[model samples]
Target: MGANDIFGVPGDYNLQFLDHITHRQDLKWTGNANELNASYMADGYAREKGFAAFVTTFGVGELSAINGLAGSIAEHVPVLEIVGAPTNNVQNNGSLVHHTFGDHKFDRFEKAHRQLGIKSARLDGEHAIDQINDVAQYIYETKKPAYIILPTNLVEMEVNKSLKDSIPNLFFNKEMNSENSFEQIKSSINNIENPVIVMGHEVDRFNVFNDIKSFSSNNNIPVLDLGLGKGNIDESFSNFVGTYNGQISDESVNKYVANADTVVLIGAKLTDSVTGGFTQQFNEQNTIVLNYENANIYGKSVDKDYNFKTIMTYLSKTKLDLSLPSIKNADNVSEIKPSNNKLTQSFYDKAISQFTSADNTIVAEQGTSFFGLASQKLPKGAKFFGQPLWGSIGYAFPAALGNQIANKNRRIVLSTGEGSLQLTIQELGLAFREKLNPVMFVIDNSGYTVERVIHGMNEPYNDVPNLNYKLMPKAFGAKEDEYDFIEASTENELFDAIFKAKEEKDKLVLIQVNMEMKDVPEQLAKTAKAFADQNK
Candidate 1:
């Protein structure tokens, strides 16, 4: 079994661990003949996947290939990692070895891996062989990219017992709602007049979106989803206050949350994205944060606090103190309409028309897609998933595959650049094998559109080789009848093709959108320029 099929980490780690990181998962082991670890073969796999991959010890100047690997893995996707370690017992004998970097080298590796938040472990001691199976199971269950170091001596050790207890759980620990915690939360809620709920990824992690929504409704509090929590509630819901991550750019939504008298932040880190560098006009004294760890009422400092579930339930049962009028008649929201740029606006309109269903989910990148696509409104319940923290190119494809597997019925829309798609092209195979019926919308302009916009690159490196994206499905082994190929060069064809694909079911569609690198939304264009100038 390969990495995907490996039920536990022990089986997968033994096969691929302590080897050069392969760009393509297939290269790890494809059940094929002529399996040689040649440099050309490894490089071919890397280039095909649009990432840098090298042998375990291939150094490219001061920065080795492992350096590049560390940087790439930091962008949110979980990875399975393995490293070479010196035998614990033999290291005391003072032997100079090239195979092992040094004593405590794994510590440095751990620090580097922490940046990516990928879990890691060492397979070195006498118990190392015995514990690997449980560690492997933990990695598979969590979907987190992990690392397991293999010691030179222990690699040959007999794996006899299962070490299940040593395997760490990657999932967050929810705080218990004790009687004291509940009382503290109830008192805090009762003292507030206008309360706003700030929700974030914790809602998704705990699978408590519906519970939180119900709690908010019963308490008559408007919910402002932090950027990470953008799709917690359906966007069209009357109580929805809009995205608090400054990117939403709605003045009314911003003002409402910023001016709240009492902010009940549940499962949200009131981080920079939600607070705009903490410059928003909010009352620190009345701000309450209920996280998985602990609850704290902020007033210059923490005042009253408790556990997350306690406060949510307490607020739900209490008499709502918010004086704000019903937001159902809210007409102050700035319209996301067309500008003088007819071509760009129309392209967005057509793209929006394609995924008109509530189940449609769009995974976008920080490239021109985020700037251009966010302008177009999604269907009532459609989600826009992006790598806001890292803004990495290749994340969307693989992460989308994982998410699609999680929610197979939803129409997953991947709006990304031609360059970005190259990062994880191997995911196409995974999607094909899994029969994920997502619309692969390629904004094919044959260049790094986002980079050029921000840096004004006149270099040859900015351009990319043109790819025949329309043939992606067939190339990846999808049957002809199981897919729809739609290529549109103009606005009319684009609109028609998008609608047609939406009408068709039980088929994967590739809509090769002929967009220009220069056709960026004006607001985004300005922001990019301002950001560039400020840095310069």
Candidate 2:
């Protein structure tokens, strides 16, 4: 209900619905090239604006967007998916429609959405307003995606004008009283000596960054974030340690987290990637896991009803002698000396680190882009978005589009591999059409570089057809003066391209950096080897 922007593609069934959106001067409609891209844009927008919506036609369009919807569900983002269906008469009569499979079963799509969505409903004439309210409430409360089917005939149907003028109050009052759960956590904190805090993506999902930051700072506890929790905390905080992912973590981070007497994990998911292929050693016995609605201490569930924010607020006010030994700081970025002027991953990493600022929102795609950018330090207030658990390639490009649409003032930097970019490259035209300016860096390393590092070093299955990435802007119908496109193979060329991109801030910029196929980040190499060994 509070969404500021809508993203979707136009279709026959959805045209009437889009007419309303187009007529409204207060609302902005982002017409994406494809339904999948639209859904991804909505996901990115939701991450920034807290809530977002995307519309699509019935079967074909909705099916294409299911992947992005599933990703929203996995990441706990609240996205409203409005599907435009056929006429109400056609649905009721079970007629074989173009979007339907000739079986007259119009509920198939709604049923499919239930698996990936927290809640779903089909709009009926008598109860459409109630259905919309319930779906919106569920989405806001659960922070997950919800699906709504809108028949073409019902686009202009209205029950009451008052429903359009006001939205239901969905925000719940914060509970101020500290309960037994808070006492239990306080006791746990007091009982343990060498306690540390481990944060995850949920901290951002639940909007508790400020509370967690206050608690961590007030207690002088060293904080380590999982991969997905990169931008949740101020990286410049003195008490903040580097990212922790078991053996893949920095040596100091691994030692501090692995050796801690009591590990406090807040909104953390022990996914395979975050835990370095499940290589982490700490178990429930030594960990206090705090979720959105519950708390677990030393393998025992707290039987009291507890809110995550309330618990964090209570912890911030409590006093504790957290005078543990300071963790060893990670080494600063080493000077990059590319041999024979060849640009290495280290050089690129350094360049990215230098280019990023507080006003930037960086999105990295799966594969080399994700692993390579993993260790780069983000500036204060800079947001980082990556789908590490979902690991969907080409997610960053459309996500960058949505993010830029949501936060028009901030610079959106998208780092994606050439191979991965091909999957969703059609969205580039939408960026041009929308006049959205985002700095896009495509790593042209031939093919699936991350996969090659894991297995099949020289297999044909890993090779991808090479395309001229610099010419994509022209192919996408961008005017000659509307965009800047640069290709770089050497260190100086790459640096100059990045510098030029920074200077040309008013227009979309694409920089294609070429590297050897075998070149991979050091951390990625180690993790790949671990995965390979385990599989063998």
Which candidate has the top score in TM-score?
Answer: 2
Tens-digit lDDT track of model 1 for 1-536: 02321111122223344232234454442211111111112221221122212223211111222333343333222334344444555555745544335452334555555555656565556466445665555444332345565655665555544544444443335455566666666667767777777777556544456766776676667877765445545666667766664433556666766667788777765444234434445555667777655667674323244555555555555554544566562635342433334345345634554446788777765566665554344557777655554455665665455455545677777777788887667557656676778777777765887677678566668788888877788888888888888887766676676678888767778787777667765545655665566567
RMSD of 1: 7.5
Candidate 2: residue 61 lDDT (0-100): 95
**True-vs-predicted CA distance for residue 266, candidate 2, Å:** 1.0
Q: Which segments of model 2 are wrong by more than 4 Å?
A: 164-168, 174-178, 325-340, 533-536
Candidate 1, TM-score vs. the true structure? 0.71
TM-scores for candidates 1 onward, in order: 0.71, 0.95
- Candidates' lDDT values, in order? 0.55, 0.83
Looking at candidate 2, what is the lDDT of residue 367?
A: 71
Candidate with the greatest lDDT versus the true structure: 2
Cα deviation at 78, candidate 2, in Å, is: 1.5
- What is the total number of backbone clashes in candidate 1? 8
